[model samples]
Target: MAISLAALRQMILAHPKALAQGLSLLVLAAAYSPVSVLNLSPVYGSAATKLFHRYGMAVTAILGWFLKERIHEMSRGRIARLLPVLAVSIAAIQFLLFKLSSWLGSPFGPVITESFTYYPLLALSIAASAKLIQYATEISRYGETIAEHGPLIASYVVFNLAERISEAFISKVIGSTFLLTRYGLQLVIAALYAITIPSKSLVLTIPLLLLSYTSNVHVPTKHTTAVLNERIQPYGFELIDRRDSLTGYISVLDNLNEGYRVMRADHSLLGGEWTKLPGQYNPKVKDPIYAVFTMLEAVRLVETEPPRPADQDSKALVIGLGIGTTPGSLISHGIDTTIVEIDPVVYYFANKYFHLPHNHTAVIQDAEKFVKKSLASPTSPRYDYIVHDVFTGGAEPINLFTIEFLQQLSDLLKDNGVIAINFAGDLSLYPAGLVVRTIKHVFPSCRIFREDAAMENHPAVDFTNMVVFCTKAAGTPIRFRNPVPADFLGSKARETYLMPKHEIDASAFETIEKGGQRLLKAASVDHIAAFQDRSAIGHWKIMRTVLPDAVWENW
Candidate 1:
């Protein structure tokens, strides 16, 4: 301890300049943090963040040169021999490890999502480049060019700023496609660097670099996964189709074991249906794999306490079509169902795979825009039933859930019309209560129901789907009659889950706590983002539990 104290004293008393330089380097390093570029946009490519680090190192190296710090460089012979040897050795090790793991059935290979050595390697390269400039280029006499590195320095600074600002940016795609493109391009650059160092190879290398850039210019994606050895051979659930949409990752997985197919938005199962023919179909089981899908059908059962109209006579407007579960049932019952789905891919897949009824009105547009337009038009038909079932991955379309939107729906609803909103949240969080409160505020007569009667594991907030049945007729009690055989539409799954059993008493959750009165308006939509994060994490965990790790991981 005394020796350490003496060393510290010496540094503070005598070696202050050295201490300042060391601290400055640390500060520079500390500035280079993992900036989350997950704004859910592909504007910035996967390689962009990696490039930012390189730019930063180059800037720092140029700065060091301007500061008259003597840098270190290796000759062409050293660069050629050392780099190829290093690259080859790493490749050989990785290949051998893969072989060993395959034979021994042991977990091997890089588990890290990305390499930690990436930035360090960039720093080393930049330092070496600066040193090369110092020795070979006669840079000591060319003092004026030091200022010319300003643009490079500015580029580095801009990258850091961009990374910091783009925390919420996420890519729409997260799979092998982006990974292959990103790293493949990077490897080519590395190869070119090794060859380009010698003057003779420039004739060959420049053309190759140009060809590589021209052929493989990266268009960004949301994320990329590290290549894993575990091949994703999903049992029964065959990937019939998949799409990367603005809303989320949509996939249609066919259950080979059950002869059913489901559409998924991100980690949440939107809806599913039985695909087997008459004799092949098991009428009693797995028709609507999830109870929530069938529960959505119960919106048909809401023939008001004030009794507006029966399902056959009702004009139903569905804001979100999740594999057409609710609308399909409505169409089956002869209701004039108009579905508003944002993603064309979802609508296409729904009809092609889930057997969605072709007779109903399909409005392929944003729910808000459609709603606004419908409200504006004097000749627009009012709806007897408006189903706001726009939920996925523990989060709802916040805009659809807003009071302003609900009020707009109210404007579009026929007198005494019913609306069923599907919300997935943890009952323990204030956000859930807030949402319920907002629903109640918009629709005076309403009843909430948990999708399933199953109890939650968490004492505080167990995330689950809950449907709120609201009516245009204020002060009228929300009453639902038991769905008879006719309402089942020859689907026994509807017969089983048409009535939501675990009805939540509004007395407990009707009032939100502090900052609870923040009723969802169009402007302040980001209020639910915090809640969404928690819910999304829970949903991800739940999905992992539902499917094998390899199934989700391989994507």
Candidate 2:
């Protein structure tokens, strides 16, 4: 031990910059990996940047500045070997840190669940940064020709580039198995230090490192449904199918107790349908679990002057196909349909699990891009009805909600056409107000309705799912024609919710708070982002009620 400690001390004194460079790389990896991991969790995925950016950045900066001297002094002592241990510990604990959620619970649970791997790894990374700063200061005292801030500047540039590259490529490559990828990269970082720094702790770390690799290997995968099922089946949940994909972790889960199946992405549920339990099998269309989706179909029922032609003659364009409930309904009615969905895996699972009919034109791509391209092309098909239902993971994609995007969607509609948008947000918040105002701004006549039973009181927080039905005819009021029985398509969910219900006063959103009527644009996305923290936290609590704790924790 003494000999190994002596060797590590010699290397630290001789190669402090070399060590700092390595630590800089380690710090960058540690800083970014957690963001990816948090994205997998339903609680943090929406507001991850806001949650960690403020606190983690402050902690890193403060520790790097205040502890440089202490870190420098400690480097010469026997305790220095333990510094590398901090890096290794991050990968080790994450294998089971999610279990902390049961003890911690929502709001606080997510914060604590992330803190386990985030802070320790960050502290160690800061120590490495401190070492570089100290070495740079010592060199400057002798007045040697060195770019004092050059190392940091270069490190910052590389760190940003790495962050961007990982966001673009690495995340796409890692997909849904990000849990294992995150830990695997962490182990690689630790191994880099152990191998390069040459510590005697390798005797212990080597075995533990091997064990961590194995533990990570057994981490969930598409093939490991049985393992996850073993933990969640007792709670009446079955993992039907799951995969890592372009958008997020896409999975099909069946709540056996409730006799319903839901398609999930990260923490948010895309959509679900009531399943055929032993006594409740329906040979016709399966009913939807959420009324909002069924309500969206009311876009077809919007009354038109000269009375629109039969359903078979009208064309429908659907953006964001969630389990294909809305579009599938459109297809069932024999309407020509085009679906623009971002994730192909979502499309695949929706078809495979939810029985999405294969008759529609599935343009598997981003909604915004698809709209822009369709608008640019003179030959693009115009739609009689446009359904926009992109809300997922507790937050709306702000870009899709912007005025420019909505105007493009408006252009895609015929003069007499109608559109329905499914949005989930707290009506009491400024962001939701902005979205409502923006939709109203683009579409002259519109009506908003909530999914569930009406809340008697409009409190400080009213988080709920709603559908907004709008029309291109400026002066005409958006009214739903009385539905004939055929409109229900044999779905009980439709019979009850096929028409928009629990009407929300559009005027209320127009004049909400100060400038509440302000429209949302591409530049105003940040304004909405600033307020998502509270909404995301509330959404997490709501999700906890939707699924058993075991489903989320096991994932």
Give the per-residue lDDT of model 2 (tens digit) for 1-555: 122565446645766666565555444554455443543354344454346554654576457545756765766633235556656665456546666665665555555654665654555555565455445434343233333454456455655565666556545565444443544445555666565455676576666666654443224444345667877899999988777666666789998887899998877889999886456546356788888888889999998776777889999999999899999999999999999998988999999999888888999988878888988899999999999999766677778988999999999998888999888877678887788888989999999898876567766667888788998778888878899988888777788888876898888776667644488888768766656767776777778778887787665
Task: Give the CA lDDT, 0 to 100, for residue 47 in model 1.
Answer: 24
Candidate 2 residue 55 Cα shift, in angstroms, is 3.2
Q: Which digits, one per residue and each the tens of the lDDT, describe model 1 over residues 329-448?
A: 778778898999987778988888877879999998988899999988888999988888787544666777778988899998878777888887677776778778888888888888
| lDDT score for residue 317 of model 2 | 98
- Kindly give the number of clashing pairs for every candidate: 11, 2
Q: Tell me the TM-score of each prediction against the true structure.
A: 0.66, 0.87
RMSD of 2: 5.7
Measured with C-alpha atoms, the lDDT of residue 102 in candidate 1 is: 19
Candidate 1 wrongly placed segments (more than 4 Å): 1-234, 276-286, 310-312, 454-461, 515-518
lDDT of 2 at 337: 97
